[model samples]
Target: AIEHDYHDDAPYYMLLAWFKRVPRSSDKVMLLTHGLMNINRWDLAQELQSIKDDKRSEQGTFSKD
Candidate 1:
């Protein structure tokens, strides 16, 4: 499970549930993009870049302004 606090007073959660899943050894990727008007951070960009560089993964999130 992955959790992000978003550094806000009101807490929010995004839950991903999978049932009867099959694993594969391929470069299948899912990207999530979020728009933020009040927040700005480049850390997410670096994280995503690192993941892509590794070339072995699935499922990720990238939040941006």
Candidate 2:
């Protein structure tokens, strides 16, 4: 589905394409992480997880002001 929708081979581009198709009500990060892991792309999954954690941390820092 991701490949058919997004014809790019790059992980970043592929992720962007896949994300666009995901429903707004869903836990997109978790879904994306699982998808990456399902394809044995644990490294990408970890990277996505870290990015999500960093974003949350930044949001928390800003909200404390």
Candidate 3:
């Protein structure tokens, strides 16, 4: 199971991503259960960067007044 404790006072997100005994998954290989909890940190970084850019744009516009 993949558990991410993002905050100390907030509920964590848990995702069952693996098998206990490496069960025979050949027939069920089509399942995308694995990597289901894979968090792409870069995606969030890009979002934060976008927000910063927007703030800068707003600041520039106000500075021109």
Candidate 4:
């Protein structure tokens, strides 16, 4: 299984995309969770906006390179 920081707020669709990108033989499963007090952070409703923007910029640079 795979685990993330939990504060990253990555959604199911994002997780699924990552999963699909994995090789079929990887046999990996991703588990996302947060502490009771931190559950809201996992929602990613706000924190991810900046991350998404940054990722787009990074991808653009990589493509240009």
TM-score for each predicted model, relative to the true structure = 0.28, 0.72, 0.41, 0.33
Q: Give the TM-score of candidate 1.
A: 0.28
Order the candidate numbers by lDDT, best to worst: 2, 4, 3, 1
lDDT of 3 by residue, 1-65 (tens): 12343554232222233333346855222222223224555554555566667988999999999
Residue runs of model 2 more than 4 Å from their true location after superposition? 1-17
Better of 2 and 4 by TM-score: 2
lDDT score at residue 20, model 2, on the 0-100 scale: 88
Top candidate by lDDT:
2
lDDT of 3 at 26: 53
lDDT of 4 at 44: 51
Query: How far out, in Å, is residue 24 in model 4?
Result: 16
For model 2, what is the alpha-carbon lDDT of residue 21? 91
For residues 1-65, write the lDDT of model 1, one tens digit per residue: 12233544223323222211324553223322122212443465456556666654433223321
The candidate with the higher TM-score, 1 or 3, is: 3
Backbone N/Cα/C clashes per model:
0, 0, 0, 0
* Error in Å for residue 41 of model 2: 0.5
Q: Report lDDT per candidate.
A: 0.37, 0.89, 0.48, 0.57
Clashing pairs in 3: none
Error of 2 at 8 (Å): 5.6
